[model samples]
Target: ERSGASMAQPETTRVFLNNVDSYASRHIAQVTFEACTDSVKAAALISDVEAELVSNHKRTFQVVGTVSHPSAVERPHRLDRDELLSKLMGCDVVIYNVTQHADQVEEALWAASALHSEVEHFSGPKMFILISTIMTWACSKPADPDDLELPFTDAIFWSRRAHPNFERHIDLEKRVVKMGKTVSLQLFSTYVVAAGLQYGMGEQIFHYFFKKSWLGEDGPVFGDGENIVPTIHIHDLASVVCSVIQHQPRPYYLLAVDDSNNTMEEIVKKIASVLGPGKIQKKPSEDAFLTKDLTDSLLVSLRMEAAYIKKLFSFNWVCQFGLVENIEVVVQEYRQSRGLLPVRLCVLGPPAVGKTTVSKKICEYYRLHHVTVKGTVSDTIARLVSSLLSPPNQSELSTLNRNMNPAGLEEELLLNVMRDELMTHPCKNQGYVLEDFPQTREQAKELFDGKEEDLSCVATEFVLCLEATEAFLLDRVLNLPESRVQEHNCEPENFSRRLAAYNEKQSEDDVVLNYFYEHDIIPLQFGNPNAEADCLPLMQKVIDMVGQPRNYGPSSQEVKEEERRKAGERLRREAQERAEVEQMEADEARARAARWAEWTKKLEQVRQQEEEELEATSRPMRGYLMEQVVPTLSQGLTACCRAQPQDPVDFLAEYLLKNNPFEA
Candidate 1:
């Protein structure tokens, strides 16, 4: 609620808000932070309101309220006139937003009456801001009915008439204005702001159309759809509220609207252009009136101008030209506010190159669904078999089997399953990491129901390709433990066959890679030797390009757990390296000791053999002496012994020669 009360005021400008849960009130609460002064605080009179709406503003604004009234009661405990007046006595501004329902009109008048009764006794300058709907002026005859070019401006608010159904609302507006006029004092003022159909921040009245378009359904346009719809962004309406609070303009009646002259059909078509197939279907005008009263306001035909506001107000305008011209901005607001945007990713890779693993990681990080070809195919086959076995009546069985070729069932079923899987609400809203599906261009076309370039509605935002050399992949499979190899079904022989098929697909002209390329979605190709380490960098690049995530990320506990896991992995790898180094050193030390022992043994053998050779040579000499030289040597020895010595060596040589002569 905008207030004339200033931050400079020593006391807080307490605001009494009714219908706090209404679409307009929620947005109004959000924009309160943008108020010129932080001194204005709100005391919300509890009604049926969304908790999320208030929770978002809790930090910035003090929203005091109790639980909603029980179904048996017309209002909460503070609805008593005396109790309400007591609540109002403490507040400087009373914002009664009656745009939501006919019931709120009565509630607002009661508040107005309470304030009027206490006009003289109020402690400070009190102002009442009434948030009304543009539908009240739906039945007003234009200034020049035939001219048609002239719009209904707020300057001629006195001449305006209310729609028959909204007479109660108009009555309340008059009562609010009358209270201000009767008060006459400068301290009391009342303003009635007739807000147009609001259409931003997930929308309100137009949500049915927005959601239908986003879901790829034909948006329904009531009747000829030629009726002019006056609309305002919720934020802009909030801004008008703020302006009224700060400026307290003299005009008691203000029209909150934009300058767009868009027909109902134009708005839906524009929404479809950005969200879904641009298709619209026209229905009877009565069909719109059949829904809730709030949505029935969409059929209101009003060409409105905020000329009075433009002349009196001086503030920046958001969406002044309105929704059609600023659709891209509005659509983004819708997507982000509701967290409806999906981070669609397709992970492509050869067999055993870690496509599934990488896709799982992506899904975990982004809170996306993991849709693998194998899982989808398996689920589809199971469903088909179960349905066939049960035979849910003959007609369904016939429909299931009709013209179905047993040979081609696998291919056809796979395509259908993948299409349905990706289009599921989980995948559409939260996004999915699809792994190794749509192996060929034809399959991609079938899945998207369009040529690669024409995929506007159901296109994957990113395509990630994980690659490795065929030799490297085969070696990797070979090196895997036997249990792991079995678990992945990638035993060396089987992996080779699958890898060969993948290589063949890569070589083909009609592969899915070409589809992605034609769509101009360049794949993040990760093929380095250390692909495991590259995953984080690849994800970071994608995140940077994609901007913020559409969903919440890992919780603090999850992050800590992941960190611990990584640290554990690092420690294990280090320990393995150390163990390998120690084992190698031990092997080298044992080898060196064995070589030394062998060398020592060989040296001992050589030494012993030399000794033996010496002995043998001596023996041979002794044998020779024993045969012929023995007798001669003995005699030579004896003669040498008897004769002494100087000639002993010569005597031995002569004895040896005598022995040789005997041999000759």
Candidate 2:
């Protein structure tokens, strides 16, 4: 009679096996095994047993006693024989599931013997139950007469052969049977069949096969079409174990239950069918089964049958689903658990084209990270310059001096330094955004070599070009603060001059406009303000276009036309300025010529008058003596010698040479 039960029904037995833990309890307990750790069959069995125990039988069993050899990695140590006997001395039933090592089984038997002998005062009808696997008896057929060694002595032989310690288990059973108490030993031959291949489930046959696929041309496979594989669903296995524990069966009964008794080929075929055609591979006949080599200590045939304990606790056969169905369920569950979902994106144009603003809006709408690639050559250079120049210390002087020539430093050195810094910076991983690298064609080519082969290697998702009128650029440059102007080395007064030089040096092909359309470095052209109304729709179209891979050739006619238009605009402005300057110079030359002509005429008139005066004085006084004539001649000579108004034309030419030497 069981405690806390209806006394009227004496045949109805309620066995209270408290804390009867073992390998079954640790694995086949309520908790599910991790996918990576155990076979699918093992997991299914454990899960099934746990479910039945929780739903049908409200039996709370904790691990009480587990006898394991010091090296047994499978059994728990906290529930040793001493602890088990102490807890079960007063208990009515002792349900023992002996599936571990032989030494453990021997220890349990010794503990039981001690409990029975030492505790004479306690009178309890203790029933000992032993569950064993048929694997402990099955042996492989001998090879040749010469190879007549003990069948189970070799590692390869023991792998397929039954356990050599089966006699010890049977001997223990006989001893218990002789103890004057009822003893039942259930010899079970059950096989655990995993439900399906899953991700991260502890080691399994599928993983073993997949890993083998990487080894060589062909992977390992099981041999012999005759070996029949019997599998039991984990849940059913647990149910059967629980059933045997609750209602004690007849003593010394071999319970042979096979869920599905199919050959290895049939099982492989079923797995292949679920996984799809051509999934299962056959092994070569030469080395069909793995053999052991002591010198190398290698197991030739990697495939091994499922452990014996799993085979003994098999349940009734249930309609098994193919791998596809199981995989679909697992995939769905994994996806849901990981929160992996589809993404919606809206990519803006190239650098400096309001892509950041648009990206922020898109991210806000989609609730995603708005990642922007910062650090253009210019920005990097500016930063480097800032660091070097900020304190105005010795280091700053050294850096500048290192790059500087005796005359001056070139801008290219600073740009190179900036490029190096940018290349070294970490890549942005979040969502899409603008990057300001690759400002030039050469830089782009350097940064993204073999872009024609693969675009993903490049740092940017898409390339965009921001277009603006030269006038607009000039205005922007001119209005910048003194510090900014100095930083870029741009002077407002020299704006037109520098622009002309820049345009002359810059190539139309060098510019990256509509970077997306072009395969090399896609360029996108955007108007001023880069308004969303205009740009968003274009961006959407570009996004759709970029979905497919493309091989864009050199710059198109449209790009050339746009560049030509800009060049024409610059030429027109320059032509107009040149014409105005020419007109001003012509007016100044005419005015200077008129003034010189007036001065020349006046000088000539003055000289004529002086000559007449001199003639009149030399005309020899009609009267007066020789002395007066000589004196008059002296006066005429003095008057002639006096500088008679230097020639104004010559004077003016000389004056211009001394004062305005460059004036032609």
Candidate 3:
């Protein structure tokens, strides 16, 4: 509560981080260490607290219990109150992290009460930071624009699974603030999944739906996905927790969420694009339990305003991994989980260059499926025209025969081809190589500008631009085989016309080229189009950029078995150490008792002798004084009287004042 006074000081503060076992809490604990103390907690199997932040975490953080583990009940449920109290006694700060439920605050506070001391009058500079969710905001209302900065005295007890036990959290937060003015109670509200390489709630649910849909068991389900879901990266959330830990902000219910301005439908489409595309079936919202909590929150149109936190701590996700980017992470993870490589690329260049050749080489080198947009478009036109001519399905043919633009058909085909290739073996091994696509400005704009709704997860890591001179282009076009010319309909005159059109359309400020360059897809122009050149070096360069996709899959049995083996080792080692410590302490206690007994016996003997000596000396001295010294002194004093026996008072005074110097 008293952190305000010492906020500027660097303290070797002990922070009691609760819920450290959780996925999110571990991040907070890791980042909080740099800002707090560096002293290790002495790594032990029984110690729930980490001795150090080794990378992210070194072990599973279980609840450290005072009582021994007995499988009779849940072995690791409660903390040993006295043992925990001892640790709490040393801590200067307590970070009360709560998730899952608001009633968790009570358990945390109860644990913290062990740190309290009435006699100490702990009006603490000691702080207790309550890092809770906005779902914990207990007001009967959804959000309080007016009193966003204030506390709610009264609140509703009941809420959806999305926000349950909110009233208790509110009660706890208010009580904590009232109890400790300087303590922080930050309530963060996030609507959607926190971004990362995660496969927890929403991601796993999405994966299930994707698997079902892909297997034709079920379709991707969302009820008209226009719900606005606030999103934030896990890293950003971790950073926010660190900021609060480092600079304890003024205690308030600070609502922090990413301002990803995408509707729920857009996010799902992005997910679907990666998983595999199919028509999404409308599912009832009420059917949503865990799976639909994602969209249900959005359906509520609930969003957290990050303005408050931003004003205070400049809350921002530097990665800027927004809705689609997060979806990309989950998609990549999904693919990797299935022993599939996740990679997407596109090669764009002008007419009559080695674009197709270089792409084919790269695809062959990597065992990837090489896709040519022109060929796919041609095939698509053929198929669609054939469908239109044949009236097998009269209704389907009627829809196909509608007045559709050639350009639109080409664009649709391009997307379809890319999607189809990505879903198949093109992405099975090393991923696909897209070539001779995005020729026109519109196509480039549609693919690269993040505008096309149909195109999802079409991020290109590299754009290989094979440059050729006008003479080389003309030569390649004009010298084409008769059969090649007849097949494609690009004759010598057609080549000149195509070259002219390309030159006219292609300018230094070409939108397509600029788009790639702006997105860090700057063209790797490496070709002597005037003459044939080896493209191995260029292909290698592209490979270097793409890097190697991790071949590891998630949750292998071997890995889990290894972890179990390590846990067993740790447990045995810890048990041995505990036994050693107990034995050592017992030995020391016995040694101390023996030494105390020996010292006590020796001291008692010495004391008795001293008493005997004192009594013996006193008897001799009394006898000497009474018998010899007193009689001799009386005679000497009588002989040496100062006054000549004249006056009694004078004689007494003279005797008392007389120095025996003359007589001695």
> Which candidate number would show the highest TM-score if scored against the true structure?
1
lDDT of 1 by residue, 1-664 (tens): 2222222222345666675656778778667545534322232323321111111222233333212345524565346667767887777677888886567787789888878888779777777899998877988988897888799987788788888888898888888888877765356789899999888887877877777776567878888999999998898888788666655655678999999978999998898776666789988988887755336677788899987566555556668898999988888788888787888888888887777667777777788889986687556556767666565634444543663564334566567667877766557656888888778888886787643333454568888877788777877777777887887879768787878888898898788888878878888877743445456776776677566777545645779999999999999999999999999999999999999999999999999999999998899678866886456667767767887867779976776666655578
Estimate the overall C-alpha local distance difference test score of candidate 3. Answer: 0.52
**Deviating ranges (above 4 Å) for candidate 3:** 1-4, 8-11, 33-78, 101-103, 112-124, 137-165, 182-224, 290-299, 319-664
Q: RMSD in Å for candidate 3, one decimal? A: 32.0
Off by over 4 Å in 1: 1-11, 38-79, 292-294, 348-432, 437-495, 500-664
TM-score for each model: 0.55, 0.32, 0.42
- lDDT: which is higher, 1 or 2? 1
Question: Per-model C-alpha lDDT, please?
Answer: 0.74, 0.41, 0.52
Q: Per-residue lDDT of 298-416 in model 2, one digit per residue for the tens?
A: 11111222232233333332223322224334323322433322222324322223445555654444333433223343354466566765666456456656777653344455444
Worst 10 residues of 1 by lDDT: 49-58
TM-score-superior candidate, 2 or 3: 3
Worst 10 residues of 3 by lDDT: 187-196
lDDT of 2 at 428: 15
Among residues 3 or more apart in sequence or in different chains, the pairs in candidate 3 whose N, CA or C atoms overlap within 3 Å are: 66-80, 225-265
Q: For residue 549, what is the lDDT in candidate 3?
A: 44
Residue 597 lDDT in model 1?
A: 97
Give me candidate 1's TM-score against the actual structure: 0.55
| Number of colliding residue pairs in model 3 | 2
